[model samples]
Target chain A: MLSQTRYRMLYLIGLGLGDAEDVTCKGLKIIKNAKRVYLEAYTSILTVGKEALEEFYGRSVILADRDMVEQHSDVILEDAEKEDIAFLVVGDPFGATTHSDLVLRAAERNIKYRVVHNASIMNAVGCCGLQLYNFGETVSIVFWTETWRPNSFYDKISQNRKHKLHTLCLLDIKVKEQTIENMMRGRPIYEPPRFMTVSQAASQLLEIVEDQKDSDKESLAYTAETICVGLARVGTDSQVIKVATLKQMTSLDLGRPLHSFIITGHLHPLEVDMLRQFTDDQSILA
Target chain B: MLSQTRYRMLYLIGLGLGDAEDVTCKGLKIIKNAKRVYLEAYTSILTVGKEALEEFYGRSVILADRDMVEQHSDVILEDAEKEDIAFLVVGDPFGATTHSDLVLRAAERNIKYRVVHNASIMNAVGCCGLQLYNFGETVSIVFWTETWRPNSFYDKISQNRKHKLHTLCLLDIKVKEQTIENMMRGRPIYEPPRFMTVSQAASQLLEIVEDQKDSDKESLAYTAETICVGLARVGTDSQVIKVATLKQMTSLDLGRPLHSFIITGHLHPLEVDMLRQFTDDQSILA
Candidate 1:
């Protein structure tokens, strides 16, 4: 009890990439001692629910959505000056830049902070049999709209492919977002959360290929037949991995949200063997 | 006890990046039930020693060096066909390619295996405030000999810089490596383990710059004044991070092994601010 009361600091604990049991013993101990525990929920999602975490830790957890985290972060850190405040995040705390912003804000406020590291998607993608060392710049594929289609990620992917390096594409996740019309009227209403599926990302990527072909601009980095690896619910028991061409992936369903897509470059013999477990197309390896 | 006896599979558990307490509750539970626990020791080093991990988990741990992992892996897996065998790895299990080879070997032998993910340097380097998404292909800087100096890593760095993407340079670790003379005599003797320090890596990199300058073959990707980040023993309490120029890093000494170097590319305003806390040279940020 004395150890708990003496230290009044901000703890940014990573929940790893799985269920409640995935929390490190060090992180779990701190969670038990913290006066307040806030689970940041906008950037990522865990496989388990809040009740599962609460049941495992035997502590109450407050879900901090985007508005609460982005706009009212001060409230999250208000009591850190006098008591331990646990700020929990899915995967590693620094996996997303938003958590770093929170850490910097705490530093600006003169509050001490501690980060408990855990497995993040950046490293867990290695489970797909691709070497992490060969991965180049990672890109994010956002949900495309009628007028707002972004393809800068395609250029980055091309750059990586030119160097024979893999590219990790993080799918879009829209949470607590509002429609343009609702926002214009100053409404706080929100749309249902949307987690991009692997098929959607593959389709969007194929569209980019078509767009480039129609315009006949610079030569494309990858074609429709280029190899791709799609990962779903990584780090859980129900995790799924599929390997095929980009065209084949457009119809492949991985059965969950929180999906990640990898557009591979050259594969080593060992990597090719590892990927063989997930795909039936043997000729692609040839 | 029945639950332990029911599962006779192989478990590849990640010890995370810190002390023994960093093991996930799920992993810890598996370790507790394991009939035999082997800690893979060659690819990486942990902050604490074998006794610390053994005491924490209440299990006797066997150190599995490169010889044991590579030459005698069948011996390590002999009992996995009938009992729970916990193979522990520092950082994430898949951080190193060697672990993947072991998994592949197990699959070939018809031994079922499960991977427990944890934080690895690939993602944990984000603690230094460089966004993970901005990183390009990761390269390794091995110790250079007079006649065997390899500069291919330089070309990769140049490629990454062309895209204004940061490069993560993984410093080399030589464990139980035999000297050329000893190997010629068929001796089993070993050299002292050498872990590359930031200053040593910086000096080697400077030599590359000098070689390129003298030959005038290809322009250097980075100069002595380019901003670099040096991280040592990340995910630990006494972890050290320094942000400075490659020239300054040549003289900088952040103690201990397991060092990682970063050659930064373009920096955003927030990234500049995040790097400010580690360096005193404000002019570089300008």
Candidate 2:
């Protein structure tokens, strides 16, 4: 074994947006040496399961579910202070706000940490031909409830459109969430929340636009006729990108859970040409 | 060897946002197997050099510089009818307009194509604590000339701020560009162009804002006191992210090239906390 400072150290590896081998060269080195490897599960999930990652890395991984992180952070953080620990996250470490919070907590405890970065969905969404710099604020579209429907995203889209910038919509993901009743009862009951699909999000957005029209808002949000791009399984083998109007997208079955949408504002000529190749109907450009 | 199909074929592989290892699992497979590998060189550069990639992948990469792609498309498109040709781009293949043009050209020639996605700077900028969905149009700030200074980006920034959306400012990179004399002479003479630094960009932007303030456009595009995040070597091991006011950033030395700036608009409580950790002076937040 190497000396205290000469041995291995804590490694925060970013499992690329898709699968197990998506791990980079530096990430692979740390994983191979880690005494205890934990996959942070709440932020995101790989297309392949934990078994697939185990086969590729040749190591057993502890599933650090939300409960583990929230309740037992000391377990992961403590070991890192003295010995080598690897806490893995799907996508880059800073991709999610939760991971940033975790890093801050570790820093407060004077734990030395190294972040091994990987491809994230934020930059990966550029596969649609939109200029990364031309993109405006990104927003998440969540499943609206009868009581909890919110239209604030409408203002954001409107603002992006006003400047002719692209808006990347990260669909909502719900993992290991509990219902209000289950929390109050203090039972271990949990409900599986739905991941927002592009189709569902578009339908909701159209309704909100119509509502804005009815309420006489000064600016129009977006119509069913507005051109949008729907992307599914972005970094995987079965990835799909389709460009169409909101009405046209309503009928698109992109397949599977992780889906995202892009509502174009004013498009550069190059952007229009790029989006046209992905669509079945070119009339969206018209 | 895999037999060549009767149909024309084009394989697009994303180089991720930074280095060669940033390639997706699917992308690496295609690049290794393809008959010809062409690197699209104009749009962006990986943080690491091409030689570093050549050493890692164990393959000779042909540079498809702008002149080669624009003036010699036949070289890339010719073998597509008989062999699988891979065109590698920094970031997702479709992240830039030039690659989109190549894809459209392939489609016109009835070529079958597959795009392997990787991360782009678009989504990677989220590491700075800005919400992906809350960003407004991303703009490119170019190196200004005394005779031809343009401030069109000012309008876009102003509009985004009014709506409380973050603006990602992609600094300009000018590689392998020619001078007016060289173009007129029809010779291969070239003039080195400038890559805009974050500090230089901030100073120019402040100048534009001052100019705009004097004009009828009284609305502030961005002020010297406005908070901004300067990011350098984003995806590399030495990546640095700093949050400071424009005035402060103008004087600080970030070191190295390929820098970007983010002019912040609105801040969520969580974003405020995250960015505060990277802020130059805590007193600025107060």
Candidate 3:
């Protein structure tokens, strides 16, 4: 049972996307009694802040940034062996590979761990009216700089389209990262967090399409007029879903970070009807 | 806001993948005060029975079978126009297309609806340590009869394997279904519910593999020794994850219903290490 009193176990709880109240009842009960509660802050973000979670949970939450989690997770494990430690994740605990690594670390130290599952973008993308079963492999679109521009995601999208399957694009997030120069100089300064918006991702994808068209027109997967979906602040009250063309997506602003995009391949009539509800221009559906 | 007292709303809540406590705090609050509560049956099953949920939420729950949800949904929508109603699903509300149809129905009747999302097998399959992003299109395996033996899922598995992407196979659940004779006779008799076990799925898949080998050796996707991951009772205290070959899977029995299988395509070193922990025979990893 989860309520075993004698055994002090580590609970990797999932705080479902949205406000503080999104946490499961079982997770909340564990958080209230845990000796130390740490929130993983890099991979994703909730609509609410740490203070809001503290207010609802009646416990102070420690923010475990990328450094603390990747470099000094031993400190987190040390306490978990003696006392019940709550390591909270914004979505499902296993959504990120790093959390799986934490499980491995805890296993190495003979520390027992339990996972509390909750909703994440991997499944919640169905909110846009697309069937989750029809989606192919999910890809990530990172922020590209002048010196480095990677287009590997384009090939995956093209493959998915070839199979008449949809693709979910997880936009990148840069949190608590250091500048290359600062990292080289051993400086502790960190850059402000930046989230890749849908417009930014659409712009990048358009460039890939342009390059592909010039090289091999027959191999192009999507064009400027292809339908694309943009969702922002999913699982929250301000959630927005917009259906438009790739060019239209480049001009569309979803109003906030934590956005995702979907490139469509085949749409059923029901899916088209559902997508029509979120589209501002019915001409796109036509 | 969800707490708006003046507006009567219909809430489609997700009762995660496990027991009663898996429901989000936001969902529990709505269930506590809802005038009428319905639990969807047939698509999935929870580890705990309906009595456990009623005892925890302090409300009597009505079991809404497929007929009630698909045909008599207008009755469910009728009351939501004047009172708060809660329709609880075994997983996330949007996991099934039926729920999406309900949303469209609610829209047609001018009844406001809100969805409280939670974990479903689509995302909770990550418990097996296969990265969620690496999964391709999900496929369903139905109970095959002597006359109707379908093998179309093999092609999809082959496609995913070609892309080096994993495939999540959802086992079929036959609940409250009538026999052909009973349906033809207009009798109300029903067959006992049957949940497809991992062993049954593996046996069926092995048959498909044998057929493929005989007809076209080049088109075969997986052999008998292909790695398959089986998970039973996920998100519960007795959750089980097992990694074995397709032949080995036919001999392994994971207790209880709602079993899922994964066909591995490409495994990262970390994924291999994580999977090794679940595998009984180390030689599989080797």
lDDT (C-alpha) at residue A37 in model 1: 98
Q: Residue B178 deviation, candidate 1, in Å?
A: 2.2
Top candidate by DockQ: 3
Question: lDDT tens string, model 2, A159-239?
Answer: 678767778887888887888898898978867756788889888888877766666554676787888999988777667
DockQ for each of the predicted structures, in order? 0.63, 0.40, 0.73
Which window of 10 residues has the lowest lDDT sum in candidate 1 chain B? B1-10
Order the numbered candidates by TM-score, best leading: 3, 1, 2
TM-score of each: 0.95, 0.89, 0.97
The residue-by-residue lDDT of candidate 1 on B155-265, one tens digit each, is 889888878889999898998899989999999999998999999999999877876676544467998888999999898877899999999999999998789999998
Q: Which stretches of candidate 1 lie over 4 Å from their true place?
A: A1-7, A214-218, B1-7, B214-218
Model 3, span A124-218: residue lDDT tens = 88888899998998999999999899989988999999998999999999988999999999999999999999999999999988876766666
TM-scores of chain B, in order: 0.94, 0.92, 0.96
Model 1 CAPRI quality? medium
**lDDT order of candidates, best first?**
3, 1, 2
Q: Candidate 3 i-RMS (Å)?
A: 1.4
lDDT (Cα, 0-100) at A112 in candidate 2: 68
lDDT of 1 by residue, A156-182 (tens): 998889888999999999988999999
